[model samples]
Target: MSAFDPVLSADTVDQILHLYATRGDDHYGEDVSQREHAEQCAYHARIDGADDALIIAALLHDIGHLLHKFGEDAADRGIDTRHERIGSGWLARCLPPSVSEPIALHVAAKRYLATINPSYLKGLSAASLQSFLLQGGLMDAEEMTAFLAHPAHQAALDLRRYDELGKIVGADMPAFDSYAPMIRALIMKDAR
Candidate 1:
C-alpha cells in the first residue's frame, strides 16, 4: 500500500504549465486543452469547498495521461493501461494519500458515472465511452457494488465532476492564479 506523490514541485507549477503548452498534441476530447482543464478543475474544486490536497488533486489528476503518453484514445484501445492507474501509481511514490487517492480512484469515478447517471454517460466522448467499457464494463453486480463502496468513492466522484465541467470552448474559465492558493495550501497540508 504505497502512498502517492506529485511530480510537480511546489517551487513552481511549471510541470502543469508545460503540460498545458502541449495541449494541442495531448487533449483527448471537447477541444479543451490540458491547461484549461486543470484550471477549471481547480476552480470548481475551490468553489465546492474541497480541501487543499483535494483541490490540487483535481487540477492534476489527469496529469497521468500526459506523463504516461497514454494518448487520446486510451479508452478505445481496450488495453487496460489506465491512465489513472499509471498516474496514481506514480503519485503514490511522491505525494501523500490526500492527493494520490483521488487521482488513483478517478477511473472508478468514470465507471460510477456510467452506471448511475444517464446524463453523465451522454457527455462522454466516443473514445472515452469505448475505453470505459474496455476498462471494466463487464464488472458483475458484486464487483460494481464493491467498487462504489471504496473509501475514495466520494473523492473520485468530485474529481469526475470537475473533469467534466473543466472543458470550455473559448473563454469564461477561471485563471491559473486562482489555483495557486489551493495548490499552496495542499502542499502545506501535506507537509504538516
Candidate 2:
C-alpha cells in the first residue's frame, strides 16, 4: 500500500512516519539510512535556528528516494531518478510551498553552489558527485541568474547545506517522532 492517502488527514503524519519506519533503512549511496539522513538534517536545521517550516523541509528533503520504486542505487546505474520533483509533488498535496519548494529546488541549489564555488564540488560525497552529474552537472551563468531570482533560493540553499552535512555514519540526532508535532502542525496549518 502507498504511504499516503490522496487527501490529507490526521493519518498523513502517520503515513509519513510509517514510510520512514519501514523503508527508511534503504541507503542513498551514503553510509546512513534515509531516516538517519533526514533526522540529522532536521536536527541541524533546528540547531541553526531555522523556522518550523524549513526544519520540516530539511527533514523530508529526500523523501522522493523513499517514495519511488527505483532501487536505492538508481544513481549508480546512471539514472537521475528526479527524486526532488517526485518528493515535492507528493508533498505538495499537503505541505505549503515553503516546505515543498525548497525540497524541489535543493538539487538546483547544489548545482548553483558547485558552479559558483568550485571548492564546494570537492566536498560532495561520492554518491552526491554521481547524482550531481546526472542532475545537470553545472549551472551556467544564465542558470545561476535564474536560480538566484527564485524566492525560495536562499532557503533551498540552506537546505542543501544541511543535506551535505547530514550523511555522517553515526551522529547524535532526534528520531522522526520528535518532529511529528511540528509536521502535524504544519500540515494542519496548510490545510486550513
Candidate 3:
C-alpha cells in the first residue's frame, strides 16, 4: 500500500505488482503500459531461452520506476530517479546476485549499447531515446571500456536487449501471478 514499504516479503511483491497494475498505465510516449513493458520483456526473455533468474530480472528491471514516489514518468520533472539503484538495492536483499547484479547494471548496459551499436541507438523508441539522454547519454570510450570488463556486462547487455524488444504494444503475455512461484522461490529465506 505504501511506496516500497521498507520490507521484503511476498506481500511486498504483491504490492509492487499491484502498483504496476494500478499506476503503470503512463508510459509517457510509449504504446505499452509499464507493466506491459515488464511482462513483454519477461516474455521475450523466455522466448529467447533465458534461464529463470534472467527472465525474472527482465520482468522486474524497471521496478525502481514503479517504486519511485514520483511514479513512472518522474524523468519528466528533470529528476534522475536512479530507478536502477533504487530497485536493485531493495532487490539485493530479496534476490540472489544472479538476478540483482544484471538489474543494477541495466542502465549501464543501455549506455554501453548506445555507444557501441549505432543501429541499436537508432532503433530506440522515442521515449527510450529521450530517457537515454536523461540516463546519462552514450558512454564515453573510457566508460565503455570499463563497462565491457564488468563481470555482469554480458548479462546486463542481454537484459538491455530484452528490454529494447519488450516495448511491443498489446502483446499477449502471462500475468504477474504466473510468475509468483518463481519469484517466491528466488526470494531469500530471511526476506520471506
Q: Model 2: clashing residue pairs?
A: none
Candidate 2 residue spans exceeding 4 A from truth: 1-7
- The candidate 1 region of ten consecutive residues with least summed lDDT is 1-10
TM-scores for all candidates: the values are: 0.78, 0.94, 0.87
**Which parts of model 1 are misplaced by more than 4 Å?**
1-14, 22-25, 73-80, 177-181
Model 3 C-alpha lDDT per residue in residues 1-192, reported as the tens digit of each score: 122223556666777668777776757358888788888889889999998889999988988877778755566766778889888877776577778889999999998888888998998888788788988998988999888888988989999989988878788899865887787776643234
> Over the full model, what C-alpha lDDT does candidate 1 score relative to the true structure?
0.71
Q: What's the lDDT for candidate 2?
A: 0.89
Off by over 4 Å in 3: 1-7, 188-192
lDDT of all predictions: 0.71, 0.89, 0.80
Model 2 per-residue lDDT tens digits across residues 1-192: 133343564666887899999998988578999999999999889989999999999999999999988898798788899999999998887778899999999999999999989999998888999999999999999999999999999999999988988998988788888889998888777756
Please give the distance, in angstroms, between residue 129's alpha carbon in candidate 2 and its true position after superposition: 0.3
